[model samples]
Target: MTPLVSVYIPTRNRSALLRRAIDSVLAQTYPEIEVLICDEASTDDTAEVVADYARRHPGKFTYLRNETPQGACRARNRCIEQAIGTYVTGLDDDDLFHPQRIECLVDIYRRHSPSFACSRFKYFQDPAQIERLREHRYSETELARADKLTLPALLYANLAGNQVLTELSRMRELGGFDESMPSWQDYDMWIRLADRYGTAVCTRQLLSFVDDDRSRARIRNSSRRAEGSERFIAKHARLMNADQKRNHRNIQYVMNRQRPSLGEIARNISLGGYKSTLKVLLHKFFGVAIG
Candidate 1:
C-alpha cells in the first residue's frame, strides 16, 4: 500500500538534533507515513544514531548514508528519488513538527488540491525555548493569489517555512531542489513551483518548533548567498518580467551598500567567482550599479 506521506529529512553532522527531528515525525498522529532520511556524509556518529532507530522501527524509517558530501539540496533530491508516497514533506534536521503536522497538511492539500502547500511555523531557540515560541499569521486565501506571492516578498520574508508538501510527481517534474545553490535552495524551488503551478496553498500553523540557533543566524555566512541570489535572479529573470527585475535590481543595489565584512565578501567571492567578487568590490567602493 502506498503511504499517505513521506517525510524527507536531509541531515549532516547534527546527530543529536537529527534524532529529535526524527522523533517528531515518529510521534506524528498521522499513521500512514514513512520517515526518509538521507545522511550527507556526516563525519559524526549520525549513522549510528540512525541505525539504532532503524533497528527499532524497521520498515517505518528508511535511512541512506552517502559516502560523498553532497550538500543539503542534493541530499533532499536523493530523498525524493528514494521516496514512495502519495505526498512528500520536508523536515530540517534541527526543526520539529507537531504531532498533527502531516495530518493537517494532508487534509488541506486534499481539500484544495494545490500543486504545493506550506504551513506557518513557530520559532524557538531550543526545547527550553518552546515557551518563547511566537506564531506568525498567514492568510490561506491571500497566499492563493499570485500577486501576493512576488519574488520581493519571498526574499524579504522566507514565508515558505520548512514544512512544504506536494505530490511526488510534481516534485520530480520540477527537478526537486536546485543542487547548485548552497543557500536559499528552498527559496529558489518555491519560486519555480509558484511560477509553474501558482501560489502555494497555506495551511495555517501545522508545522511547529523551528529552532533559530547560531547556525540559522549565520545563514548570511553562506559562501554562496550573494552568488546564489544572482544565479537565482538570472535563472528566473524572465519570470519576474521586466518591471519586477528592475525593482529587484534596485533592492539588490541597496543591499550591496549595507554589505557585511570584507571576510564575507572574500568568502562569497571565492565560492561564486572572481567576477562576482569584483562586482561586490565595485559596489562596496563605488556604490550600487544596476547590472
Candidate 2:
C-alpha cells in the first residue's frame, strides 16, 4: 500500500546529524510513512549511516546516493521524484522533527484539504537552548487577517517550518524545488506556491531541535549564496505581483547592500593616491552612483 506521507531528507557530509533527523522521523506517531534519504555524494560516512537504517527498516526507508555533488536543491529534487506517498515533507539533515509532527500535519491536511501546510518551529543551539527558541505562539486570528506572506517574508520569519507536506499534484504543478539555486531554493518554491495556491495552513510548534552552529550561519552569510539568491529573485521578478515584486527587489537590495562600491574599490586599491583621490572627488562632485 502507498504510504500516507513521504519524508524527504537531503544531506551532505553530515552523517551524524542525518542519523538524528532520520531517527526523529522514524519515531513519529504516524506509522504509514516512508523515509527517502537523498545523499549528495557526502564525503563522510553518510552512506553507511543511511544504509544501516535502510537495512534495518527495509521497505520503510529508501536511500539514494548521488555520484556527483549537485548541491541541496538537486538533492531535494531527487527526493521529490522518488517520493511515493500522497504528501511530501522535507527534513533537513541537521534538523529534527517532533514526534507528533507528521501526525499533526497529516491531520490538518486531511481535515482542511489545503494545497500545502507549514507549522511553527523552535530553534536551538543545544537541547537546553530549546527554551530560548520558544517565543510567541502563532495565532489563528492573526494568520487569517495577515497578508499572504511572500517567500522572502517566510524565509525571514524562519516559519516556512521544515515539515512541509503538500499534495503531490500541487507540488508537481509548482515544478518541485528549483535545482538552479543551492541556498534559498525552498524560499523561491514557497513564494510560487503561496502566490498560486494560497498561504499554507498553519500548525503550531511541530518542529524542534534545530542546531544553529556557526558554520551553518556562515554558509548562509557567504557572498556567493547571497548573490545566487539575489539572481533568483531578479529572474523571477516579472512573474510576481506588485507586492511580491517589491519583496523580491527588497531581498536583492538587502543581499547586496554591504558590498563595496566602485568608488570604494578604487579608493582602497589606490590607498588615497593623488590621482585616485582626484577621481573620487570628481565622481562625488558629479553625483555618480557607483555601485
Candidate 3:
C-alpha cells in the first residue's frame, strides 16, 4: 500500500497566510497525504478559514485547535500527536512546498531509508514567484541530489534547515520539538534525531521559504535568542568539542546583535584553530549562513 504522508502546519492568527499554505499542500502531486493543521487559539478569521477548507475537502484535513494560544512548539507537538499518517513533515504556516515535495520525500524513503531527510529551500519575497520556482529550477543539479550529514559538522550548523521528512514514529521517539528552547527548536531536535538514529541526508530540491520581515530583521530582534543559544549549548555540550563550544559562545554575541570581543575572537582562533575561526567568521561577518 502507498504510505500516507502527513504535512502538519501549526498556525496562529494569520488566516490569509494559512489559506495559501493549505492550498499548497492540497496542490501536491502526491496522492496520499493528510494535512494536519493546529490552530493555536487564533482569534481572527482562523476558525472560519479552517472551516472553509474542511467544508471543501472533507477527509484530507484533521484540524486541532487550542482553547488558548500555546506557543509554536507546543502546537507543533499537538499536531504530531494526532497525525494519523505513517510519514510526516512540517510546513510553517507562511512557507510553501513544491508541488512534488511529498512525492520527493516518499521517493527518498524508498531509495535510501535514512532515519530522516531534509533539503535546501529557496527564499522568496514575492508570493507569485512560488508558482514559477516550485516546478522549475535552473539546472538538473538542483533536483534529487543527496549528501550525508555528520553530527560534528551539524554541531557547527544545522544543515537540515527547519523541516525534515521522516516517519511519525521517529518524530515521536525523539519527543517532538523541544518547548524549552526559546528559538533554534528545530535545530536542537534535528541534531538529536541525527545523532541517535544515524547520519541523515540533505537534498538540493527546494521548498519555498517566505523571505519577508519574519525571516530576517524580526528574527534578529528576538529577545530570547541569547537565552536559547545558551540552552542549546548546554543541551548539546556532550556532543561538541572545546572548539565548537568556543565558536558557539562567540555566535551568542552575533545572536544578540553584538560583535564578538577581540579577546574572544583570539580565543576562538587559538583554541579552534584558524580554519575553524575562519568558518565562524564567514558565518558571522559575511552573509554566509551557518544553519
lDDT of 1 by residue, 45-133 (tens): 99899889989988878888789988888888988999999999899898887666676677677767665777677767667655333
Best by lDDT: 3
Q: Which scores greater on TM-score, model 1 or model 3?
A: 3
The C-alpha TM-scores of every prediction are: 0.76, 0.74, 0.88
Candidates 1 and 2, the one with greater lDDT: 1
Candidate 3 lDDT tens digits, 83-168: 88899999988888877777776776667887688777766678777677876643334546777777877788767877889899
Better of 1 and 3 by lDDT: 3
Task: Highest TM-score: give the candidate number.
Answer: 3
lDDT of 2 at 25: 88
lDDT of 2 by residue, 64-99 (tens): 889988877777788788888888888888887767
lDDT against the true structure, each candidate: 0.70, 0.66, 0.78
Q: By summed lDDT, which 10 consecutive residues of candidate 2 come out lowest? A: 140-149
TM-score winner, 1 or 2: 1
The TM-score of candidate 3 is 0.88
- Name the runs in model 1 displaced over 4 angstroms: 1-3, 131-157, 215-218, 250-291
